[model samples]
Target chain A: DQQVKQNSPSLSVQEGRISILNCDYTNSMFDYFLWYKKYPAEGPTFLISISSIKDKNEDGRFTVFLNKSAKHLSLHIVPSQPGDSAVYFCAAIMTGGSEKLVFGKGTKLTVNP
Target chain B: GAGVSQSPRYKVAKRGQDVALRCDPISGHVSLFWYQQALGQGPEFLTYFQNEAQLDKSGLPSDRFFAERPEGSVSTLKIQRTQQEDSAVYLCASSLGQGGWGLRTEAFFGQGTRLTVV
Candidate 1:
């Protein structure tokens, strides 16, 4: 069963615009959420994350907002750049369990210059 | 040495063949995990190791799949009697702690080994 889901398969946006990627999860036990960006033939790199205690976390141009009541989260990138084009995956894990991260199908984001 | 390293970036094997994939995690990392990624799908966890002790391996698909970490440094994923459905990208990741310190140390991933069984 897919516990974490990214409904959008792909997204396109112009450069210098704000890009928003959404993710939803059904597992209420998940306490930590992370976003990863992957390029062709490369491993997925950690972008940002948020915990159940906090509703939001920001790093540089990336910001992750979590809504526990709705079981939804979003990754917002300001001034999207062409280099940011890649497959973005959202993952969740229970902090106390095995810590095995459950990942979404991923969303491909393209930034047109 | 500096990052998680997975060898044999690409591998092609015939049906019924056995293949072993290797992973070398960063020095001093205490947690190691293996994941399998299929085409157009996200990565799914396969197994996990903590200092040579395999704490979790519930995600292993079947009995033909086996993994080992002899010295707590390097790991190997062995698939016996490989099948076409076994083809996918196998990834290895490592973290500094065992999630005990409450530090959200992100796991670093290797490029991954793409396995194709024909």
Candidate 2:
């Protein structure tokens, strides 16, 4: 059973527009959630994270909204640029045992110029 | 190294062969983790080490998979009797904090080692 899921395999957005990527989870034990961006032939880099205590976190043009009761989260990028094109992965960690991160299948986002 | 480093960016092995994947974490990082990513799938946690002690190995797939962090700096993941299904990209990541669940330490990753079992 997948604890975290990114149902959309891919998404496309126009530059200067807003791009929204969604994720869902089944496990309620997850307390910390993170988003990662990965480019071709490179490792994933941390983008942003949110704790369960908060409902939203924002950094620059990027914002992450969490709905704990719905078991869902979404990443919003305003004024999306071509450089934002990449695979986005959503991961969650429980509050114990080294906090092993559980990842989703990932969503490929393409920002058209 | 300035960031996490993984050796043998690519590896090809035949069935029944044994392969070892190496990971060099950032200098002074206290937490190390190993994850396996299959095609079109996200990375799955395999194991974790806090300094020299392995705090978690629950994610390891099977008995054939083994990992060690002898000196608390470098880690190696070994697979005995490779199978075709074992093909995947093995990723290594590290954090600067000790073993704490509530701590929000960011983990940095390496380019990973792609393993192909023929």
Candidate 3:
């Protein structure tokens, strides 16, 4: 069973607009959520993360919102640039229980110029 | 190296052959993890190490897979009698602390080695 799910396989947004990608999880034990951005032929890089204790965390143009009660989270990129186009993966981990991370299938975001 | 490094960026092994993949973590990082990623899928955990001791390996697919980090800074994942299903990208990541809590310190990943078993 997949503990993490990114139902949307792909999303498209125009440059200078806001792009939102959503993810859901079934495991309640997950306390930390992270977003990683990956380009073709490279390893995934950490973008932003949110601890379950917080509802939102932002870094420059990237912001991650966590809704623990709903077991859902979303990543928002404001003024999306063409360079932001890539695959975004949502990952979850139990803070002190397990060292491994469970990742979603990923959502390919295309920012059109 | 300034970042995590993996060798043999690409490898093609015949079925029943054995292959070994290597990883070099950051100079002072204390945690190392290995994950396998199939096409169109996210990375799955394979094993984890704290210093030179392996703490978790429940994610390894089978007995053919084995990993060791004798020096704590370098690790090797070896697969024996490879099968077609063994084909996937192997990624190695390292963090500056220990255990699950250490991951909060930001795990840096290597480029990953793509293995194709024919």
Candidate 4:
């Protein structure tokens, strides 16, 4: 079973617009969450992450928000740029013990100029 | 600093052939992990190792899957008598701490070794 899920398969937006990617999980054991951006033929690059202690975390243009009760999290990018076009993956990590991260199916985002 | 690197970027093998995939983690990193990603799907955990000790291997699909990191710097994942279902992108990631520090440290992923079992 897929513990983490990204309902949207793809998204498209214009430059200077907003791009919102969402993720949800069924496992309450997950306490930390992360977002990664991946380009074709390349490995995933870490974008942002948040611990359960906080509801939101921001890194410049990337902001990640989490709702513990809802078991959901989202990544918001304001003023999106063409360079932002890529696949975004949401990962939920169960901290301590094994720290095995479960990832969502990923959303392919396209930013057009 | 150099990031995680995986070898045999692309490997094509017959259904019954055995295959080995390699991963070289970042220097001084204490944790290593392997994951498998099927086409159009997210990555699934395969195993985890802290130093030379394997902390978890519950995610491995079957007994044919074997992983080793004898020296603690590099790792190898070997699949014996592979089948068509074994075809997937095998990903390796590493972190500074034994377990992912989450907010403080993020696991760095390699480009991955794409194995195609005919």
Candidate 5:
């Protein structure tokens, strides 16, 4: 069974617009959520993360929001640029349980110039 | 190296051949992890090591899969009698701490080695 799910397989947005990617999880034990951006032929790079204790966390143009009650989370990028076009993976982990990360299928985001 | 390094960026092997993939984590990092990502799928955990000691390996897909980190600085993942279903990109990641602290410290990943079993 998949503990984490990214319902949308892809999303598109215009330059300078806001891009939102959503993810859901079935495991209540997951307390930490992370977003990683991956380019073709490269490994996923850490973007932003939000702890279950907080509803939101922001860094630069990237912001991550968590709704623990809904078992859902979202990553928002404002003024999205063409460089932001890539695959976005949502990952979850139990802070004190396992050291492994459970990832979603991923969403391919296209930002038009 | 400044980041995790995985050797043999790509590999192709016969269905029954054995193959070994290597990973070199960042200097002094105490934790290493291996993940397998199939086409159109997210990365799946394979195993984890903390300073030469494997703490978790429940994610290993089969008895054909094996991994070791004898020196704690480098790791190797070996597969015996490879099959077509084993084709995937194997990724290696490392963190600066031990145990679950590795995740908290944010593990850095390598470019990954793409393996194809024909």
Candidate 6:
């Protein structure tokens, strides 16, 4: 079973608009969430993360919102730029033990000029 | 400072051939991880090492996959008998910290080794 899930396979947004990517997890034990971005032929790079104690985290143009009640999280990028075109991955790690991160299938974000 | 570096950025192997991939993590990083990324998919956890100790091998698909971090530095991932299903990009990442905070620490990744099993 997929504990972490990214329902959207791809999203297209115009420049200067908001791009939203959503993810959900079934496991309640997961307390740490992360977002990573990957370009072609490259490893995924860390973008931002939020601990379970916080509901939202903002960094520059990127923001991640967590709703524990719904077991859902969403990343919002404002004024999406062309450089933001890449695959975004959602990950959750159960912090108490070996702390392996469970990842979603990923969502490809395309920003149009 | 140097990030994680992997050799033989790309590889091609026969169905039954054995292959080995190398990873040189950032200097002094205590935690190393191996992951596999299939086409149009996210990277999947494979194995993890803490310094020279193999703490987690549960994610490895089978016994054929072996990874080692001898001397607490450079590491290698070897596949005993390559299978077509093993065709994917293998990524290596490292973080600074012990097991307790390892998950919360940011992981710096290498460019990855792209393996194609024929």
Best by DockQ: 4
For residue A20, what is the lDDT in candidate 5?
A: 97
TM-score of each: 0.97, 0.97, 0.97, 0.97, 0.98, 0.97
> Which pairs of residues collide in model 3?
none
Over the stretch B1-118, how does candidate 6's per-residue lDDT look in tens digits?
4799998899999999999999998898899999998887778889899999999998899999999999888999999889999999999999887642225467888999999999
Off by over 4 Å in 4: none
lDDT tens digits, residue span B2-118, model 4:
899999999999988989999999999989999999999888999999999998999999999999999998999999999999999999999987676465566789999999988
Better of 1 and 6 by TM-score: 1
User: Which residue pairs collide, candidate 2?
Assistant: none
| Residue-wise C-alpha lDDT for candidate 1, range B33-72, written one tens digit per residue | 9999999999999999998999999999999999999999
Of candidate 6 chain B, the 10-residue stretch with the lowest lDDT total is B97-106
Over A45-112, each residue of candidate 5 has an lDDT whose tens digit, in order, gives 88888888999999999999999999999999998999999999999988877788999999999999
lDDT of 5 by residue, B1-118 (tens): 8899998899999999999999999999998999999999999999999999999999999999999999999999999999999999999999988743224577888999999998
Report candidate 4's fraction of native contacts. Answer: 0.82
Q: List each candidate's DockQ score.
A: 0.65, 0.68, 0.67, 0.77, 0.67, 0.67
lDDT of 5 at B66: 100
Give model 6's clash tally. Answer: 0
Task: List, residue by residue over A1-113, the lDDT tens digit for candidate 4.
Answer: 88999999999999999999999999988888889899988888888899888999999999999999998999999989999999999998877656678899999999999
What is the clash count for each candidate, in the order shown? 0, 0, 0, 0, 0, 0
Give candidate 3 regions above 4 Å deviation: B100-104
Q: Which ten residues in a row have the lowest lDDT in candidate 1 chain B?
A: B97-106
Residue A7 miss distance in model 2 (angstroms): 0.2
Reference-based lDDT, each prediction = 0.93, 0.92, 0.93, 0.91, 0.93, 0.90
Worst 10 residues of 2 chain A by lDDT: A93-102
Residues A1-105 of candidate 3: C-alpha lDDT, one tens digit per residue: 999999999999999999999999999999999999999878888999899999999999999999999999999999899999999999999987779899999
